[model samples]
Target: MRVLVVMGSKSDFHIAEKVTGILDEFGIDYDVEVASAHRNPKRVEELAKKDYEVFIAIAGLSATLPGVIASYTTKPVIGVPVSAKLRGLDALFSIAQMPPGVPVAAVGIDNGKNAALLAIEILALKDESLKKKLEEYRERMRS
Candidate 1:
């Protein structure tokens, strides 16, 4: 299984790295893309069609990338709100307050690591190896 990590801008790549770094720790396969819900909506639409188990969309400001991605696919989308102006709260609300149907699980401001963990947990639901890995990860956290 693979996860797709998309960001609204190239500048958000730094935050996205925190996600990929944790995925690497768990040996999860993933791909990253720089696409914006406003500036590059078409790219986001197309990428959503690609094969992937989960998506993590990172954005700041009027963060609409996560919502846009959620609109195109039924797969789980986790949002990481980058700490831009408004300290990312605007983004957090934009993502968390998505309308009734289009759901996007949002993490804390600039908390890409949690976004990654959430995605991994979703994938582990049907992946035995990943499930075992996550169990070990929890054990480590408890130690």
Candidate 2:
């Protein structure tokens, strides 16, 4: 798969659906998994080790999933902060304020679509067809 979409809990699946919808439209290969960094650190670590070009981690209320995953692998990680608490600011800060060395790209709160688009952009670096598709998508957006 080109992308791996991981949610911290089953409740976040709704947001994940937004991500998958965009990926589907772009015909990108992806797999979804529900694993929490707090509850299942080992599983999160394992998932990070998998072979994927990009990762989209959706979490809220101390969203540590993205940073944790970024620590495990050098691949790009896009963090989607769900609006679970504190208007999702807590999650947003947690994701955006990653310590220097380990970085996770943070999207807007509950913005899975942008996260998916960012992943596509990352993948497009090495994929000419995807680059063309992304250009077409942007043109459509401009209309």
- Model 2 error, position 38 (Å): 0.7
Candidate with the greatest lDDT versus the true structure? 2
Q: What is the Å distance of residue 31 in model 2 from its true position?
A: 0.4
lDDT of 1 by residue, 1-143 (tens): 49999999999989999999999999999999999999888899999888898999999999999999999999999999988988888999998999999999999999999999999999999999999999999999999
Q: What's model 2's lDDT at 114? A: 97
Candidate 1 segments exceeding 4 Å error? none
The lDDT for every candidate, in the order shown, is 0.93, 0.98
Query: How close to the true structure is residue 46 of candidate 2, measured as C-alpha lDDT?
Result: 99
Which run of 10 residues does model 1 get worst, by summed lDDT?
A: 80-89
lDDT for each residue of candidate 2 in 1-143, tens digit (9 for 90 to 100): 99999999999999999999999999999999999999999999999999999999999999999999999999999999999989999999999999999999999999999999999999999999999999999999999
